[model samples]
Target: MKHILSLFLIHTFTSYCQDTTYNHFSVDAEFGLNNPIYPMTSGYDAATLNLWHVGLGFRYAVNPKFGVRLSGGYDNFRELAGTPSFSSEYYRVSLEGVANLGNIMDFKEWTKHIGLLFHMGAGYSVLNGSSIDPNHILHGIIGFTPQVRLSPRFNLYVDGSVLANIYQNYTYDLNSTRNTHGIDAYLINLSLGVQYNFGRKEHADWVVIPENNEEIQNLRKRVEKLEEMQRDDDNDGVANWLDQEPETPAGTLVDTKGRTLAPRDSDGDNIPDDLDDCPFEKGSAAMKGCPERSGSMAPNSSKEVITMIEESEVKFETDKADLSPSFQQLLKAIAKVMKDNPSYKLHIMGHADDRASEEYNMNLSRERANAARTYLIEQGVSGDRLTTEGFGETKLKNPLRTVEARAENRRVEFDVR
Candidate 1:
C-alpha cells in the first residue's frame, strides 16, 4: 500500500510540472448518502439508506480527454429499526483514472455548459465500529460524474459510484466473521459536488489548438509581399514593378511606360517654348531661339554656323531614336542654317556607347542619325542636301566606361560642306 501511494504521488508531481496554456487541476467536495449492502451478521439487516456520507478529491487532467484523481471518503452505516441495532464507519482512500466524456464526444458543439466524466480504480478501505475490531480490506470503485459549468473557476456535479470489497473478516454488526472469503461486501454512494478549477482562465478540456500554425504564418507573409509590389508610392499610374521612373513628380505628363514627357520646345532649340523669344525659329542660347539681331555683331559665315551646329550635337538616350523636345529644337537650328546656306550639303553622323553587340549598336546608331535627319526635314530643310551615317562606338568623344562618357558618346554630330 505504501509503494502504491508513493507511485501515485510521483506521477501526480510529474504531471503538475508539464507546461500548459490552460488549467488542468481542480479540487472536488461532495456530501450525500451511502448504502452498505453486505457482510452483516446472520438475521441482521442494515438500513436501506444511511446518512452522513462525505468525500474530498483532487484531479489532474493529462489532456483534454483524460485525467487521474485521488480522493478519500467516509460513510456511516446503521441497522434498520426492527433489526439488531449496530453502526459502522467506513473510510477509504483511492487513486482513479478519469475520462472526460465531454471532450471525447465533442459536447461543446451543442452546449458549452454541460460535461461528463467516467472514473474507475482500486483502493484500501477500513471498517471500524464500537463493538468490533477494525477490519481492513481492498475495494474497487467505479463511478460517473455529470457536471454543469457555473463559472470559469467552478462547476456543479452529481456523482454515483459502487464500491465492492474483498476478503472481509467481520459482519456489519461485528457479531461474527464473514462466511465467504472474497468479494464479501458492497456499498453504493450518490453525491452532489462542486469542483473549483485552478490555473489559467480556460481549462484545457475545452480549448482546441490547430495543427498548421507555421503554414498559416507563411501564407500571410506572402500576401504582404505581393501587396508591397503592387503599391505605387509616387501615385503614378504605373505600379512600382513596371515604372521606369517611379518618383516622377506629381501631375507630370508620362508615357504608357511611365517615362516623363519631354518639356515643350517648339523650334527644336535648347530653350523651352514658354521661355524662347522666337518659338517658331531655331536660334542660339544667347539669342533665345531666334536669329541674331541686325547690327548686334559681325555676321557669322556658313562655315562658322556649321561649326556651332557640330558643337551643339543632338543627344540620344541609350539604344533609343526618339527625339526629346529639347533635341528637336537643336535640329531646327541646324535646318535653318542649311536653308540659309543653300549651296552647302549637311552630313549627319550618329554614334553609340559600347554596351551591345557590334551589329546591334551599328543598327541603333544608324536609326539615331536618321531620327535627326527626319527632324531637319520636318523643319523645312531639303532632304536631298542631308546625308546620314552610323559610327557605332568607333568615334566615342570620351572613351572611358563611365555614365557621363557613355551619355556623351550617344549623340548625332553634324558636318557641312
Candidate 2:
C-alpha cells in the first residue's frame, strides 16, 4: 500500500505539475475491498474473494475548509462456511460532511497542493439473496481521504471508510434454526479513486510565501532614507545633507558649496551687497564706496556705466515724479546689474524743460531725482552711495525747439562712476 501510494503521488505531481484542480464541485469513482467484521459463524474467517465494492460519489464544497458528499455503491458478501457458498449482495447509499484539514490549518506552503479530508455520514443499505428476504438496514459511515492535486479539473485520492449497521443477521437458511437479527455488522473499505473537479478556477497550483518582519522593516527604513535624501526643504538645488546654508531663500542661486550667491544689489547701483563698501548706498568700487559728484564741473563717470544708467532713465509727467510700468522694469534691470557689480555707484540727476518758473522747475527736478533715488533704495541699493540733484532747465540733451524736444528734456538721467 505504501509503495503504491508513493508511486501514485509521484505520478500525480509530476504529470500535473502545472494544473490546479481544487474546484468547488467534484465527482469521484472508487473500487476497493470491503472487509466484514463482527457477524461471522464459529468456523468462518473473513476472506478476500467476496468482499469488494465499487462506488460513485459527488461532492460540493462551501469553502476550502468544509464540504458535503453523497455517494452510492454495490457490495457483495459471501459466507465460506456453507457446503458450497451463500452469496448475498447489498446496495449502499450515503451522505457525508467533509472537512479539509490542510486548508483549514494552513499547512506549509509546499503542502498546499494536497488536501486531507475527514468525513462522517449516515445512510441505508439493502440486502438481497436467494435464501433470505430482501430488506433494508440503517447504517452509518465515517472516513478520511487524502487527495493529490492534478489539474483544475482532476485529482487523485484514496478513500477509507467504516460502514456500520445498527442491526443485522448472518442466518440465511430456512432449514437451519438460528437467530437472524441481533448482531451488529460493520464493513471496512479502503479504495483508490480519481475525482474530477468542476467550475471555478482554484488557487491550488502553487504556494506564496510572505516576506518576514525583518525584511519588511529593512525595506521601510531604506525608503525613508531615500526620501530624506531627496527632500530639499529650502528649494535649493543642494539637498539638505550637503547644503551649508539650509535656510537659503527660495529662488536664491547657490554655488557648489551650497552658499547663497552674492548676486543681489538693493540700491540698483550695479554693486553686489557683499563687495560694496556701502551696501545700502549706490557707489563704485574705485571710489571705495562714495556717491558721484553732484552736477560738478567735470563729471567723473565711466562712459560704459553711465550708458547703462542712462538707459535706465525714466520720463515724467510735466510736473510729477510718479514712474511708469516700463520705467519700473528698467529700474529692476538696473537693480540686478548693481547687485552683480559691487564697486559701482550711481549719480541721479533730474532735468526739466524751460516751461515752468525757475523755482518751480528746480523743485520739480529735485522731486524727480529724489523719486528715482527712493525707487533704487526700495529696490535694495545702498542709500549712502546714491545722491540726488536737480538742474532745472539746465543740462538739456535736446533744446526746446519742438514739442518732442521739450518732452525729451523733461527726464531723469543716471550716472555710475
Candidate 3:
C-alpha cells in the first residue's frame, strides 16, 4: 500500500506540465478478476481463474488535466477455498480523483489513441461469508488505468488497483498462540472496461456575423452621394451636375465645358467638319459626313464592319481583363462607331490559350469579353448593342504549339450584324 501511494504521488507531480485539453465528462463499465492479498503476504494467492469482478463508473473533469470519478463494484472470490484467503464475496464503492497523464506529459499526438491515468480514493467495503463476525470495513484505493481511445466519444480501458482495509479476523490463523482479529489486509484488482465522453462540438472556432452598425450605413450613403456629385454622364468636358448640353455629339466644341458651340465645316457640305469622316471633301451627314462611296451612300455589310473592328488596335494584359490606356482609347473609337451606326450590333468573342484548366480558361475568356462590353457601355454604347461569348482554347488563330501561336490565340474576335 505504501509503494502504490508513493508511485501515484510521483506520477502526479511529474505530469503537472503537459497538455490538458481532454474531454470533461465520461461513463465507463468494466469486468475483470480480483483477489485478496492476505496481510503480510509477499505475492498473490495461487487460486483458480474463476474468481471475477464487475463495475461501472462516471467521471467529471474539472479541467483538461484533472477529473473525479464515482465507481462501484462487486468481487466474487469463487476460488477463495482453494487459496489461503477468506471473504468469498466483496462489494465496494469509492470516489477517486483521476490524473490524466497524457495531457500532463505533452504526448497527445504520439499517444493519440492511448492514455495513462492514476487515481486514489477511500471507500467502504462489505465482506460476506466470513468467520469471527465484523464483516464490514473501510478501505483505501490507488489505481493505474490505461485507456485506448476507440472514437471521439468512446474508449477501452484496463484498470489495476491496490486496496487496503482492516478486518476483524483471518480465516487461516498464522499464529495459533495469539488471537489477533484486528489486522490490516490488502486486495489486488484488475478490470477491463469501456468509457464514453460527451457534449463538445466538432469545430469550436467559427464565428457568426452580427447586424450592421449605423455608422457603416451612414458611410455607404455618403459614398453614394459623392459618386453622384462627381459623375460625368456624357464624354463632353462638363460634369453631369453642371452640363446644360448633356447629349452633345462627339468632338463638338463646348463653352466653359458645358454648352455646345456651332461646329465649323471647312467644306461647303452641310455636314460639320468635326463630324465628317471626309472633312476636306464634299459630304453628307447621312454618310457620316463623307461623300457617297462608288457613287452611292449604302451601308457596309456585317462582314466589312467586323473586319474593320478586327483591325483596330485593342489588347489585354496576360491572364487578365484590365485594359491599358491605349486600348481604352481604341475602345472609345469603337463605341463612337457603334453609336453612329445604331443598326449595327457587335458580337464579341473572347479566347484563351491552352495553358490552364478548360473551365478556368473559359472563365478568363468570359471576363475578357465582359471587360470589353463594360468599357463600351461606359463610353455610351447601349448594352443591347453588344453580345459576348468565350471560347477557351477551342479556336486557335495558329494551331502550331509555340509561344507566338499561343499569344495569337489569346485574343478577342469581333463580329458585327
For all predicted structures, in order, the TM-scores are 0.47, 0.42, 0.39
Total clashes in model 2, counting residue pairs 3 or more apart in sequence or in different chains: 27
Considering every candidate listed, which one attains the maximal TM-score?
1
Cα TM-score of candidate 2: 0.42
Better of 1 and 2 by TM-score: 1
Ranking by TM-score: 1, 2, 3
Predicted structure 1: lDDT = 0.80
Model 1: per-residue Cα lDDT over 235-283, one tens digit each: 7667788789999988665665678877656557877655665544567
Residue runs of model 3 more than 4 Å from their true location after superposition = 1-23, 39-50, 80-87, 130-134, 167-183, 200-417
Best by lDDT: 1
Residue 417's lDDT within candidate 3 is 71
The alpha-carbon deviation from the true structure for residue 135 of candidate 3, after best TM-score superposition, in angstroms, is 1.5
lDDT by residue for model 2 (1-417), tens: 999996785555434433433345567899887766656555555554444779999776655677788999887766655444556677889999988776666755556567788999999887667777766777899998888878767778898888887555443221233445543677788888888765455533212322143576789899999889877889876788888898988867676547886575545678754455444456687864536656652222335445655665578867788875445556665665566566777888998888879999998999998988888889898888788899998778787578888879888888775
Looking at model 2, which ten-residue stretch has the lowest summed lDDT? 203-212
